[model samples]
Target chain A: MDYSKMCPKFESAAELLGKKWTGLIIRVLMGGPKRFKDIKEQIPDMSDKMLTDRMKELESLGVVKRTVYPEMPVRIEYELTEKGRDLEEVTNSIQAWGEKWM
Target chain B: MDYSKMCPKFESAAELLGKKWTGLIIRVLMGGPKRFKDIKEQIPDMSDKMLTDRMKELESLGVVKRTVYPEMPVRIEYELTEKGRDLEEVTNSIQAWGEKWM
Candidate 1:
């Protein structure tokens, strides 16, 4: 196979998705928008610092949207954008593979 | 959502796939077994050492298999195991997503 002809977009996507803790964070958010604490609670093994970093990265990539709801106490939530929501297939496939193999 | 109920298998799978270059390497091998030089040539940005390390890691995880063929000159090849071939869905999904978004 002429791998040199491989798509650059797929390469970029692979690099982005393959980052440490990024996939898990995205998977957690796939449930719906949640507060910072809530997201942290889901992936117990990940450090708060790591979660924060991944969240920021995802947000910057337009895969996640950070919203601050202002009331008496501001409620900040992280939700997937349309682009991120499109990743459901990717994550779900991983989950399926993991169940069978991992 | 009860984040505590998240599947550990999924988490482990995410971590493994999310490793840098692992996804790309798997995608390359998806074509078929290839020589080390062929694989390296496909992904220009990756260093030789990094590719070696990732290959070893994937082999250890049972995702990749290394075989040596005896001939006039030694022939070595790397190929995906059943487990690795199963990741086509995961990689294809990522490719689809990348085509649409990235």
Candidate 2:
């Protein structure tokens, strides 16, 4: 995402997190660890396809992690990377701002 | 805009600023004041209709202000509102994060 062509920080920020399930997915993963089913349970409205797509995008951005376990059903879990963890502070501020104005 | 249903702050934040021209529009207005033409000049890729729509949306959100001067050659300029001004600090952090990461 070469955002230098654009001056707004929010443009790239939005592009990074603006996808349909991106933010909510991150918020869900913030809990620590979760499986595909667990994430789907957390967001009942999200389609399986969209959730999968978002996970791939976050993983590519180095903001999320995916772990697989050999099991009867082939269990897998998702977690936030260190870079993603830092977003807690920023997102907290965003929450404060949202509650204040909106 | 009612984001209480979502724990992810970025969801709401993205929704508020994630639209096509939303972020770039805010970034451009950060300079101080600009007219419709000035904004278009700043962002050559933006279409007139999109610019008009974005200005209306920002104005309604109380993030951008529109000042119009009645004259043969009408003069109009957009400035950031107090609420919008507060975003400067937040956006700078976003910029830093972007440069650090993607």
lDDT of 2 at B40: 79
Clashing pairs in 1: A18-B18
Question: Tens digits of per-residue lDDT for model 1 on A1-102?
Answer: 234456788989998998888888888888898888887787788898888888888999999999998977988999999999999999899999999999
DockQ of 2: 0.34
Predictions in order: lDDT: 0.88, 0.72
i-RMS for every candidate: 2.8, 5.5
B2-38: candidate 1 lDDT, tens digit per residue: 3345778898999899888888899999988988998
lDDT of 2 at B63: 90
In the range B1-102, model 2's lDDT, one tens digit per residue, is 332235544556656766676767676777778778777776788899999998898899999999989987888889999878766655565666666665
